[model samples]
Target chain A: MSITKRIIPCLDVDNGRVVKGVKFVDIKDAGDPVEVAKRYNDQGADEITFLDITASSSNRKTILNVVEDVASQVFIPLTVGGGISSVKDIRALLNSGADKITINTAAIKNPDLISEASNAVGNQCIVVAIDAKRKANSPNGISWEIYTHGGRNSTGIDALEWAQNMELRGAGELLVTSMDKDGTKQGFDLELMKAINDKVNIPTIASGGVGTLEDLYDGIEKGKADAVLAASIFHFGTYSIKEAKEYLSKKGINVRNTYD
Target chain B: MNIIAIIDYGMSNLSSVEKATKYVAPNDSVVVTSSPREIDNADKVIFPGQGAAKNCMESIYDKNLDKIIKKNSKEKPFLGICMGMQVLMSYSEENSGTNCLDIFEGKVKKFKTRKDTKIKIPHMGWNKVSKKNDHPIWYKIKDESYFYFVHSYFIDPIDKSTVIGETKYGDIFSSVIARDNIVAIQGHPEKSSDTGLQFLKNFIGI
Candidate 1:
């Protein structure tokens, strides 16, 4: 059967606390990771993602502890990312109760890490996160280029080409974040999403830029994303996951009936 | 006292299944154990698995769990999930072909997505499961209600009567199958939110 579109809340964690920022900088502390996760769980969030934005060696253990704490409380699927460079990191996070591990910077540096981790674990548990921004003028005329290190550096890798390579390398899912749309809250980069969604054979999660309920709708209906991942919208109390589901359901989007 | 033993063959992180079972039926003793005696003696057994079928079968065979599962499924209430459900079939095309538990007459085939088709493999996300028959497990979960699924292969049962629920991806496939004391689903009910908890509650109550 066809899958219903998902609405996920992405919590950027730094030093064991939930944080958010604009284009991966100017971070703002949101609240306790466990509390926010539990609330999202109660609100019927389709899934939750814990992104360790700190990307620091000292904060690595704290993030794992945070994952354990949140995993114990949340019943839905949990994905942990940030600073996951090797198969060992993937194993540690999965052991700590994360359902999936997202690899970003490490994957760009060493694309084979995607296949290595997927082979060690199942492809279903491996998520390759691609951060990109629209490139207007390029040698190859590619519309987007991959950005890494929290969107601070451009890798010059064609976004579409990288997405195809990740899928070929056995990535179960793709988390595509549009750096231009991050923290803007305007809407998702529909063009970028459509480009990757049309080519990739695995589910692609559209991240960044979700301001209104309609943006979430467009992410799936127009952008063709299997799941919509947002950060500030759900974290800052602008809207609830339940509200988003109700809104999507009203627009004829197949959403889980969370009627308690 | 209802003792629900979730057979742990080291194929899955049974913590979520145990936690959900406990949440649904607090009075019941939900144990995640590979002990054959515990599984055989329990009032009900929950068989949950994930990952590749080849690796899953290897672990099951290593622990000689297939025999225990087959023997217990006929006598007590049994629930299989994801890979746990697939292994109940006759065979799987995964891992260059692997023989399954042969409890059901069916074959597990991988999704064949054509180049022009937009259907994605691994079918990861939430989808509606249309109920075909009235069962205790369908208690609060409405017909065609959305449930989470993440799998590339699906079961094609020979006996259509055994299928209690069906879902549509590229083609319609059996998402939920039931016969006598056994109930199995392709979706992970533990990961499915509240409606899934209700499904577990129905199984526990039954």
Candidate 2:
């Protein structure tokens, strides 16, 4: 059996600074991305995801230097996403020591990109990211639509179906974020997450709406997600990785127990 | 001088183990070496491993550390971790044809669970270890102290008396096994926190 229940800390990098906000509002620069990533790595984060939120729109270099700087400091896996569209971009990220590359809007624009990227990099190195928002009026009744362009554009593509297709295209994992619940701190969208997880055999990492430790637990236990990704709670030091892991261990969630 | 020689068998997280040993046994000498001679001369030996069990055993054999480890076990303190602990068993069902160190008369078997259960494989993360006997290795640790574990196969001790600790997944399994001077833990003591650190300290004293 593969290793499951990963505790990930998402770094939303803007202008090379780590920033996070509630509901994507009042975005505040957290700290240096390398420094913050080092802190999480020292604290025992299972994996680190660096999402360059500004890379796509600004066309700025995805901070390969910063990725290299952080990767050199830690031994755990590092994943980079945002503005990663082509196989070349994936190559650049991998060359910089990124263990995985997450493709979001590019995957939505050209579904075949998944197959191309997977063919170039191993399937284990390619991750498909789905930014989903709940829709009430779909024919299926309460459907999840794919949002692209950094959650600015909504493509009517059903998230559940897209996830299944991406897996078939050889995506090793799926990073699913609920647009409605992102940065809300309320919790993860369990219904939408379960919808995708039930259909795909690959690992699904639930993103957005993580306010507290309970919210993360819900994403793993109730949402049935293989991993839970959070930003604000971890960014502000509201909860340490050790604390969250201890809480999960007490709940019988099979978390890495480092505590005495 | 209580020199702690951590076996460097090309496994993951060896640095972390060295760091943790340093943290616990600050004044004592802690060195990670693949040399069997160094291991033989060390006051204590720690066998830490990750990745596959068969691969780990092959590494020990390739480096000719098997005889050294077996010989040292009779005279020095030893601790095996994760796949390290699994490899101490007689054989593993992992590769089907590979034989383990056979130090302990037991087989490393895969976790048996029902299909409908939500339990995932590779049982990653922290869990509590129930004491089978109040061994000195667990000194300063409570009855059910939590320790970090990441593996799929577990040792089924043929000599239950050697089992020092047990942890429950879907079922209760051997977490730590000790026979005479050889003490092997299935969890990563370096990654594991205070209790794990204290356990390492106690092993050093032994």
Candidate 3:
């Protein structure tokens, strides 16, 4: 009836291998990016995000190889994050078959990177990934502050204001991860998601800390995110993308039916 | 089994489309190029693009692909996608109103945005597209099947008969248009998973 909220499966990659436990059967290699991605694709994942956790620059090729492998077989949008600093890096990833590239610390270091990259390649391919951590107490009515280096450091940037600025810089989408809720399984930072969604017109992907399928549904319902990204739930085979969509669809969330 | 040319007017990342097309039709020669000669010689031509309408049109002109596109749409099987589909319209309100290729008498209008409604701009995500008028592209694709869509604007064709498919955000809008040898889809079939792959397969077959 209307646009279905996207359900994206996040794959954490290190040295070209999927680092998380993908409990899907028939997967010959646990670390093979293609195998894991193909499994997600078969399960009806709307899109796949590959985050290279490796800080080693040499291992960058491994991620590129992984991207090329999955992209050749996976007939869905592919988003790559981590180490996307320069325009050349973005070009390389896109050439290697990434549909979109996410820039985080680099963009914060140089805000112009968002503008330059979006100008070079359409904004649709440039996603500004923001890791937000709640700033204890604020008199200014601020909810979250941006974090960097995998949530290891804080940038002291207001999440909402930065979101608006990124949108102004022509970011196609925002992938906001709540450091507070992430890995806690407590659910997404709904307050942060809603704030970003309300401030910017571009699409926002709600991520970090999804313990249950109900959390994903609430992300769209309460957070009002255009898409939801989760790892442990889908990665561990605890739930499939099809199951997730069916759950959301049943809740009047308007999700795509994984299997037509 | 065929030489498929994906028209690259510098408006898109043509890899996904080219890869999807190649995955579906491995035997076919799928090349992403702005060269008019390649488009002219191909058995099937796919017009896939994204970005502003004005920029896309300007790129098409810069590449001198307008004549080839116009010629192929009439004589050969052609499938236009997203911005590609938009450019085929008579005009667009984007960029403070811009002129298009005018293959069909239509205008691309932006979706209304309000502070109160949950409806977001760009209409970004998968949505159900119902068949308005049946065609080969709908071969095995069921009516109201879900497809990927991510755009702020949509086309309004003057001739409703040409609108083969429709989707609703706040109101019903044309999602697919077809006339003669040309079919334009507002959604990205390449990124659309199985349903989209099937649609592209049908286009390749045609």
lDDT of 2 by residue, B84-132 (tens): 7888888889877569889999889987656755454446555778899
DockQ metric, candidate 1: 0.60
Candidate number of the best DockQ: 3
Alpha-carbon runs more than 4 Å astray in model 3: B115-118
Note the residue pairs that clash in candidate 2: A23-A183, A255-B125, A255-B126, A256-B125, A256-B126, A257-B126, A258-B193
Cα lDDT tens digits, model 2, A27-111, are 3333666667656766767778988877455544646776766655454567898888788888777766576789988887888
- For model 3 the TM-score comes to 0.96
Residue runs of model 1 more than 4 Å from their true location after superposition: A20-30, B114-117
Given candidate 1, what's the lDDT at residue A242?
89
Best by TM-score: 3
Winner on DockQ (1 vs 2): 1
Model 1 agreement with the true structure over A1-260: per-residue lDDT tens digits = 35778888898888888766322112233367777777777777889998887756976888878877776666789999988889988888887778898998899889999888887778999999999999988775558999998689999899999999999998999999999999898999999999999888899999988999999999999999989998877766688888999999999998766764
The regions of model 2 sitting more than 4 angstroms off are A1-176, A196-205, A212-221, A237-260, B115-117
- Reference-based lDDT, each prediction: 0.87, 0.78, 0.89
Q: In candidate 3, what are the lDDT values of residues A16-74, reduced to their tens digit?
A: 88897988878889788998888888888889999999878877788878888888898
Two-chain complex of model 3, DockQ on C-alpha atoms against the true structure: 0.69
TM-score between candidate 3 chain A and the true chain A = 0.97
> What lDDT tens digits, residue by residue, belong to model 1 across residues B1-206?
79999999988767678777888888889888999999998999999988899999999999988899999999999999999999999999999999999999999999988756557889888888999998888987788877788899999999999999999887788999999999999998887877677888889998
